[model samples]
Target chain A: MAIYGVALLAGCMMFGLIIGDLLGQVLGIEANLGGVGIAMLLLIFVTNVIHQWGKLPDSTSSGITFWNAMYIPIVVAMAASQNVAAAFSGGLVSLLAGVLAVVLGLALVPVIAGKPEPEQDCQDEPATAVASNTAGSRRG
Target chain B: MFESLIELFDEYHLIAAFAVIGLTMYLSNWLSVRFTNGKFHGSAIAILLGLLLAYIGGVVTGGENGLADLTLFSGLGLMGGGMLRDLAIIATAYGVRFSEIRKAGVHGVVALFAGVIVSFLAGGIIAVGFGYTDPVDITTVGAGTVTYIVGPVTGSTLGASSEIIALSIAAGLVKSILVMIVTPMTSRIIGLDNPRSAMIFGGLIGTTSGVAAGLAATDARLVPYGAMTATFYTGLGILLAPTALFLMVRAIA
Candidate 1:
């Protein structure tokens, strides 16, 4: 049932947070080492397995979708509580950080974006003509 | 009875923060719907409000933790802790399908690396300019350009000062807001109409909130495509910022 999938999702989330905490402890970072992201990956893999074997119910899939949609809004809401105080009071140092980022980001745009068409090796300009010729030759 | 009620509020100040945040969300959404025509999502506005509230709380109380410094709002410290943040991020994965990520291909992958490295360098250079000679501070700021999430992680790992870490987060936040505001305006010039283009854009920009919001405004259909790579961008940034990137920065500056 869909309820089972939701329960499984909760379990995965809890498990991920624990692992993330443990990872942070080991890494000595004092943060949650991408715990949510790991959990999401786990859920994606588990759900796929469930779907592949013809076991996942529509209800469960919907439940997953519902939670997925809520994730962003919740994340955005949570981000408001971030340490803006530090950023604001950090003074000219932080100001330079944003300025430099924008300058460098704009400069790199040309090199890093939308050049895949040049890398396309094959040219299939006349797909219809080639297909028609092949068909006619075969029939003849 | 009134004194007891006040005590109860002091005990559950977190609930007050929640109430305030919830109301802030509603007001933000209404403002978005009315003025910007939903161009700016409620999430962004809510953040603004929350920050304003925190600033007010800090000014009023002259406390260290902003609203958390107030006895009636201490819950915010825990509520805004890593636990909920991590949980929310995990939920974001539910919507993602791995196959979609694969469709971005080699170019998207390249963009991810380029995005992170270039952003990091930009940030590091600024940190250096600001007299932050320490590698930890430089690397943290540099990583901040990659994404907000990477900044704190790198800072904590390298033992950067709290102020520098905050600066990094600010740097990332500014990048995200800029990307969000600029993406829709430049979408046509950037050819961000297709799924592939969106993927590359996401990779290059690497701020999930900004990418998603910008894409939503530009073309709702492309949000998922863009956010996928953006999410991966965060993961990669986290992996690289403290270890490989930190070493590279140390060698250079």
Candidate 2:
């Protein structure tokens, strides 16, 4: 059953990579497109479909849960392989790109999120609640 | 006997590498709980430690592959290679439920698109600011801002040089680490207490590990919701980065 889960995952990965490769070729690019991400979508689709048919046994689902936690170690392996020195030596461009992306993204959070929900405690105090509500909506 | 044991480790370097990483994770988790009171997830610390080790490895070995350059740790290269990375990414999808994602509704969808475009523009504009004229290079770095995985995927597909690819990866790594560190601190201010907000946050952030760890630190219950959208962000980035986005960058700069 565990192997079945991995087998399913592997199958999805294969198809994903194939699609990625084809997409690259069609676009005249030399590298695979979002193979890993496609594989994830496939996995989600397959697993959802199967669950609809019947409940997947605990043992079967454990295979996936097992690998889910394994993501951390795998990512650590990735970090270990990265060339930090080379990137820093490359120029300030890399640093700037990274910092700017995150900063701008974080700033946009409020804009995308719009107004915050009214606090529960504010409801208890009628007078203060009106003032805070107005202030919150105005800021939003 | 000792020499043969050493040879065995060399031959099974991947296993040795796993052991080392396991130890690092354990220690990171311990540190997170003991010192940071779990406000910082173990994974972030582990990555920082990994990066530190990599820097030290590069300094010591003076080779391109970092710690893997040393024969004993050579397995780190393959362990960290594409095959496993892809597998890890896929495996993360196993537990995500579509029902929860649907609950995020239109806001979630909008957040995903907005997140990717904003990140791409930021990266591309910054790349331009830095004097990277080639559209391919600009797109690749921009894609990296989407996520480290997206960067290399975009870079290689667009025929970016190895140096540019490395920079993309670095840019992504920096973003991931920053998200992990900043999330908990900003959670209250951002009101990231609910699953809906977390999903939007994940979509906006667009880094699976970063969002997952950050949410884990802020509120463990929000992880799956956030992670699901974050996963989609990567897929969307992959689809756009090498195709439409690249073309737009070319036209602009």
lDDT of 2 at B5: 76
Give the alpha carbon lDDT tens digit for every residue of A51-123 in model 2: 8898777788777777766766776776676665654554577677767877777676666666533434433
State the lDDT of candidate 1 residue by residue for B1-253, as single tens digits: 9788768877777677667567767898899899989877666566556556656666767654555666666766656555554444444455455644454557677877887888888888877876888888889989887787899988887898887777788788767656655666677776676656666777778777667556654655565556556656776788789999999888986
Best by DockQ: 2
Ten-residue segment with the worst summed lDDT in candidate 2 chain B? B96-105
lDDT for B35 (candidate 2)? 100
> What does candidate 2's lDDT look like per residue over B76-182, in tens digits?
88877668766766776675555444545466778888889888888888889888899999999999888888899899888999988988887887777667667
What lDDT, from 0 to 1, does candidate 1 have?
A: 0.66
Clashing residue pairs, candidate 2? none
Structural RMSD, model 2: 7.0
Chain A TM-score of prediction number 1: 0.61
Model 2 lDDT, residue B130, Cα: 82
